[model samples]
Target: MVDKAVALLANLSTIAEGRLAIAREGGIPLLVEIVESGSRRGKENAASILLQLCLHNSKYCTLVLQEGAVPPLVALSQSGTPRAKEKV
Candidate 1:
C-alpha cells in the first residue's frame, strides 16, 4: 500500500501542480522517512518523488534538505537497490 502510494506520488511529482501540492501538504518529511527505511521499491519511488520535487526548484530542494533527507539519500545512493540509487 505504501509502495503504491509512493509510486503514485513519484508520478505526480513530475508535474508542477503535483509538486506544489505535495510540498504544501507536508509530504517532504514522509518522503524522507520512506527513503530512510521503506522497502526497496518504496525507497526508490520516494526518492524519485523527492528528486522530482527538487528538480529546478531550490525551494523544494531546501525543504527536502531541511527535512533531513540528505543522509538517507546518501545511504541509499551507496547501498539501496540500483533503481533507488539512481533516484537518489
Candidate 2:
C-alpha cells in the first residue's frame, strides 16, 4: 500500500503543481524515510518521486537538501536496487 502511494506520488511529481503539492503535504520526509528503509519497490518509487521533486527546481532542491535527504539518497545510489540506483 505504501509502495503504491509512493508510486502514485512519483508519477504525479513530474509536474510543478504536483511536486509542490507533494512537498507542501510533507511528502519529502516521508519519501526520504521510505528511501532509507522501505521495501525495494517503495525505495525506488520514493527516489523517483524525490528526484522529480528536486530536479531542475532550485527552491525544492534546496528544500530537500535542507531536509537532509542527501545522505540517504547517496546511500541508495550506492546500495539500492538497480531501478532505485537508476532513479538516483
How do the predictions measure up, each by TM-score?
0.96, 0.91
Segments in model 1 whose C-alpha atoms lie over 4 Å from true places:
none
Candidate 1 residues 1-88, lDDT tens each?
Answer: 9999988998899999999999999999999999999999999999999989888589999999999999999999999988888878
Tell me the spans in candidate 2 whose CA falls farther than 4 Å from its real position: none
- The candidate 1 region of ten consecutive residues with least summed lDDT is 48-57
Candidate 2 overall lDDT versus native? 0.86
Error of 2 at 87 (Å): 1.3
Model 1 global lDDT (CA atoms, 0 to 1): 0.92
For candidate 2, give the lDDT of residue 2: 91
Q: Name the lDDT value of residue 52 in candidate 2.
A: 84
Ten residues in sequence with the least summed lDDT for candidate 2: 53-62
